[model samples]
Target: MDPAIASKVLPQGLRNRLSASVRLAPDPRVHYPGSDFPAALADAHILISGWGCPALTGDVLAHAPGLRAVMHAAGSVKSLVGEAVWRRGITVSSAADANAAPVVSHTLALITLAVRRTLSMAAGYREGWPAFEARSGADGRTVGIVGASRIGRRVITGLAKADAGYRLLVSDPCLADEDARLLGAERVELADLCRHSDVVSIHAPLLHETSGLFDAALLSLIPDGGALVNTARGPIVDTAALTAECASGRLEAYLDVTDPEPLPADHALLNLPNVLVTPHIAGAQGDEVTRLGRYAVEEVERWVAGRPLLGEVTRQALPRLA
Candidate 1:
């Protein structure tokens, strides 16, 4: 883990628990992209990794001859793992599951607001209170989920159990009809999902095929006054097309991630009242970060006890992950 966030991620109390199970390195400091990094890994049997850790390239791995596993205290090992780690046959795990609860909760909150026309209605407040006929709620509204990825699945589950009586529709080529039905959703094609949904939430991975999926033509299919939510990657939605829709007040966008991400200071989307662009904070942050450290530490204990790891990642599954 990076020293900068070590206190929050692995505080003294957790460190004491960790110390009881594994031998603390002689130098209990941290480094990566530093002269002392290689020396730190010299006699390691297991590596506890997190954000800011260097990719385990072959050269870096050479320093840890006996390293058997890596427990990452963060989401997505895609950027941290490489061909070298897999070739060495080392076990790898991520704290993505632990990080997912917050994103799922945030996304669900966004969906609740979107279905209620919260942003548009709030924008209308300056002119005068919205008419009783113009107001709406989540009850009986159809919500489209773009991909049934890990976080997406949880969002669907949340919607399914809502008393608001949401009609759930999911879009993912990998989905089976039975799977959708079991999740209390109907599986549909992407265009069909866009055409009929009152709100479309993106959960798909950003792949070559998914890039710009909600292009001008498809975005135009969303009913006038509908909303679009992207808690996934930014490139999956066409920024220019989305901006035009929101600017016209014909649609609302709740975006947690954006294409240029952080967007330019003067981007039209930022100035739109009905469109929201958050700083990718739907995931864990603040005190919630402690969950990731706890998850990673638990995985370490499981591996040491010869128990099956709960969050293992394999080379074959990296492409499908966020």
Candidate 2:
């Protein structure tokens, strides 16, 4: 319920629809005063949440006697949703699919640029025309995707349509062989994908098991001059190891997220010629936020009409999602 999200991101029509069907609390901050919230929640049948919405705790649930569903207008419900909501049988829907487009599009663009060594080429162009060689082309290059998450699948779809003759490799324990084949990618182990790929893009989630999944050893496995793209969480890859690899000019990275995000201005990563860092802007920018708001509104309408939501989150998926 951040003010910026409510006032800027959501469309007026969607906001009007939500206001009509749900009793929206006016506070834009994450948490509300106990007195203000308890009274408002008592008759609340559905909660529409967005960035900065308060965590739905057991104590909070105790106040909402009639709450049946929650519609989230953003990606990743892990931060706001807790066990209490699930335990109370409160259904939930997220606009993650709508938000995935920006990340997937960003990844595809990075893959194309990295394969062509665009960053280096651009730097050379700026430093006055210099003799250059077409060292690497996208033709016959291998693109390894770390996970077949929503964003990863979309990236594959775009890659499939590109003129670049790139062989696709995928690594995800949960991804079945049939699913990989359907995406036109060959299934492989994480290390094997890193070893064989000309460009490796990570789209995995940040969970206990996935934290620092790409450490020194895994990073070292990337063939020299190969590019690594991480549109996923920063903690998934060891920040220090990535900086070291890129600093040595043995690897190139297009990182949109990083551990301890917003790395200091003086961080070595900023100085590395082979590294391109973005401030976690890969997902849901510009008018894309309207997509998320519209999705949440539609989900709310579905719940009211007794239809199942298209973006329903299962209790079982929470463990792998966070």
Per-candidate TM-score against the hidden true structure: 0.96, 0.92
lDDT digits (tens) for residues 1-322 of candidate 2: 6756565556667778877766565642333433355556777788777887778888878889899998998989998788899889999999998898888888899999999877766666766775646456888999999989888888987898885799999999999999999998999999999999989999888988899999999999988888899999999999999888888888889999988889998999888777899999998986778888899989988888889899999889876763
lDDT of 1 by residue, 6-44 (tens): 788888888788887899798777676765776688899
**Model 2 lDDT at residue 225:** 81
Q: Which stretches of candidate 1 lie over 4 Å from their true place?
A: none
Q: What is the alpha-carbon lDDT of model 2 when measured against the actual structure?
A: 0.85
Number of clashing pairs per prediction, in order: 0, 0
Best candidate (score: lDDT): 1
What CA RMSD would you report for each candidate? 1.4, 2.4
